[model samples]
Target: MTDATAIDTTGYLALVRRKRLYGTLLLAVFAALMASGFYVADDRNAGGFFDGLHRIFDFPAEIFSEAFQNWRNLPGLFLKFIPSLIETLNIAAVSTLFGALLAMAMALLSTRGLALWPRLTPLFRRMMDVMRAVPEIVIALVLIFLLGGGPVPAMIAIAFHTTGALGKLFSEVAENADTKPVEGLASVGGNWVQRMWFGVLPQVAPNWSSYALLRFEINIRASAILGFVGSGGIGYDLKTALQWGQGKYDQVVAIFALLFLTIMIVDHFSDRARARLVKGGRRA
Candidate 1:
């Protein structure tokens, strides 16, 4: 027994040493690859990375200098852009609402043990993977070309990406749900809709709401950028301000302030709501 125990201990130490050696080698290889890639990219650049590094703050300095000199213009610009700001928020809100609703349906349809058609689960999962894989900006650009640029196209773009993102998250949450309730409902002759509505939804609603809130915050930023590509929101206004160069820097600052304030407000409320939802915590 003593001999066998000694052999086992020796083998365990050898295995640990082998794993550590492999891990170190892997880390070294990864670092080398990253260093090589950086050098390759820098060589390919028209202006080298280190060469342009010092000038990076030039544009920010110009913008701030002009914006500060024209500080009094900020208030008017803020009031002027409020309507466009609302439009941007509208795009985000509509997209999040539609996307979350579709995500809930797709999540239920794709989740194993809860799917209405288990055989089609792979198909739905692949569909979501594709959806999530494509960037929202790519979709927005395509739709803008086809639809001639508006909030509608931006809304569709954000919603499309949101569906895939939220569907994946919602499905993950639904997968861990209590199977007992689902089983009990099905045993009572409940249809697929009934079983999911009564069993799965209740179990996952808090988590789902938290995810949706987070997505809504992200969509606001996306929609703002989409507007820059001619989607008719505050982003479009910002683009116009940028095109005007020196004279419009104050407008640019105004738009930035609005976007910053809006994101901060949304993030604050969403954090509180998620805390309350996921933990039933206090308002703070």
Candidate 2:
């Protein structure tokens, strides 16, 4: 075998010489400028910044104190908050459920390779882009203005946003699905929808279900924020508590903690369900 350690100092130095110090310096300067711009745009005072920074060290204590200050009054708080919380969940559930159904249709449209009229592809893509571009809160605010405030507006807002996001994800999944079963279905003279139903759906159904469940959890959080614009939910309670300054910061904090717990629990269950589904599918 030939020895291979023949590299020289000149070549090594030449390699090192190619390192672009000016490019790196330019990048550092660009980053610093961007950060400075962000800081200026934020308009936070130095004193307020320092105070907020100091509070981070005591955040856990602050959160705990805020949650537990009115432990005795929690039952009454719960009595008042439960109805709104239920309404929030209902809004999230109905929104995600109905939105997922609409997303299923849109998803079919998104996978242009599966569609005959390719012209519809751009239109569907643009539709999804538009829907997803508008945030749920903006949608809720607009719907509230148009339809008047109630759960309906909130539901519609959540549903539209959910459909947009879920459609995009579902289409990507569908597009990447195994084509073998689809080919078999086509060979057997099955139609497009039939091929999708039996072949594509079976392959991606588990992932789709998991995505929909995950979206439900997200919609719950969105539903909470919808109340800021009078859409009604836990957010309304939070807004009221803040506005009234009735020393109900503790109540608001407790409710928020509860919302956090609910999300965590839902995530755990959804993960378990997805795992079970994946395992069952593999076995089948």
Question: Which structure among the candidates has the greatest TM-score?
Answer: 1
TM agreement with the true structure for every prediction = 0.92, 0.82
lDDT (10s digit) by residue, model 1, range 154-246 = 999999999999999999999999999989999999999999999999889999999999999999999999899889899999999999998
- The local distance difference test score of each candidate is 0.94, 0.82
> lDDT score of model 1?
0.94
Q: lDDT at 36 for candidate 2?
A: 94
Q: Give the lDDT of residue 87 in candidate 1.
A: 98
| Backbone clashes in model 1, listed as residue pairs | none
The weakest ten consecutive residues by lDDT in model 2 span: 1-10
- Which segments of candidate 1 are over 4 A away from where they belong? 1-13, 282-284
Residue 168 lDDT (model 2): 95
- Which lDDT value does model 1 have at 258? 96
For residues 54-148, write the lDDT of model 2, one tens digit per residue: 77757466645765776777777777788888889999999999999998888887786775456798888789888888888888888889998
